[model samples]
Target: MAKAIRQIKQVDPAPEEWQAASLSAVVKAAAENGESLIKLLEIIKQLDGMGVLNAMEGLLQNRVDVAEIALGQLNQPTMYHVVKNGMNVFKFLGAIDPEQLQTILSGITSGFEKAAQSGGQESLWKLGKSMRSPEVKRSLAMMTGILAGMGEAMEQNHSLPEGGTDIG
Candidate 1:
């Protein structure tokens, strides 16, 4: 029988050999991805021409300082409210029906155009007569519904102080 193995010997490549291997692998990759490498080079050239590369390099070099400044700005009371309100607005929008919102926006745009054509010259009599129209009545009903919804939401969200009346 052969003698049992006592240890293992590992061979390590010299630094020059390692460099050559890495270069060969990179050359093979370049050959395989010639088109992508060309596009990447073009993008790099455009960014350099626009000074974006230099700006990015500077930003990276002072990342800690830039982060500190950003954090400091974000920690301000106004920024806190801005971020909070922005998130709330996003949530509110997310809850809306996009098609319904689009219809409403288009209606508002058309109303503005009509108003411009009228040049705000409509008499009180005409305005009063318009209230009898189905469109006006529908708009009024929508407004009333909105007000009712807002009242309900406000009552749910805000508590009255001790002995405070709802008359206000």
Candidate 2:
């Protein structure tokens, strides 16, 4: 017990000693992560070149005013609607099947290319023939089905969970 107390008394560090210890630890860490340090320095250099550092410094200088402005903006109805719509869009995206969505996007791209290549207005008979195309009929069916489902969903009454916030 006496030896333990003696060791603790002997090791009581000054402020400068603490600072030196921290610097030594940091130096050791930098040596161990030299590659990571290089990459971090490169990222910092790019940010500085982009004037992001200056922008950050300015933001820090006027942090209180910036925060107040941000808070005021968030309180506005326009901001609220923007946030709500963004959230709903994200929710809708999450609900979609990614593979199916990709296929639909590919189809749209093909349609655009075909339209560009055609480069002219279609005759009345050609327009009527398009209605008989399997792809067109399939797309119309899918679109109508989606619209009907959405209409039904809109008409249905929904209840939120006990702790859930009102989405509206």
Candidate 3:
């Protein structure tokens, strides 16, 4: 048996040696993932060719100014309303059934085509008679229903004076 060890000395690696070791590990990993490394290189080449890399580098260098400009634009009341209206539009669209919306759009397209073909000179009597048709009745019902629903939503969501003032 050997005598008990008095001290343990740890030798720190030189900077160059440490760098070489790290590079060797990276090389080994790149070898192991040759296909992925090639694909990544290809993407980098394409981005560089398109000047996207340059743009990104510039953006990174001036990120503080870019952020300030963006924040200033978004801080406006108009921007606030725009963002709010966009969200409401998205919500409204999401609430509708896609198939029902498609049907409605198709009907509107067909109606427009028919109206165009009619030369817009139909007499009031003819228009009144057309209202008796099932298609016209169906469309009118849909419009009135939409109006009623919109009225209900307005009443529920807004606290307007007797005759509403247009804030828009």
Winner by lDDT:
3
lDDT by residue (43-156, candidate 3, tens digit) is: 999999999999999999999999999999999999999999999999999999999999999999999999999989999999999999999999999999997787777878
- Segments in model 1 whose C-alpha atoms lie over 4 Å from true places: 159-168
lDDT of 2 by residue, 18-51 (tens): 9999999999999999999999999999999999
> By the lDDT metric, which is better: model 2 or model 3?
3
lDDT of 3 at 148: 73
Clashing pairs in 2: none
Between prediction 1 and prediction 2, the one with superior TM-score is: 1
The alpha-carbon deviation from the true structure for residue 105 of candidate 1, after best TM-score superposition, in angstroms, is 2.5
lDDT of 1 by residue, 1-168 (tens): 899999999989999999999999999999999999999999999999999999999999999999999999999999999989999999999999999899778878988999999999999999999999998898799888987887678678775455544455
The RMSD (Cα, Å) of candidate 2 is 7.8
What number of clashing residue pairs does each candidate have, in the order they appear? Answer: 0, 0, 0
- The lDDT, on a scale of 0 to 1, for candidate 3 is 0.94
Each model's lDDT comes to: 0.91, 0.88, 0.94
Provide C-alpha RMSD values for all models, in order: 3.0, 7.8, 4.8
TM-score attained by model 1: 0.83
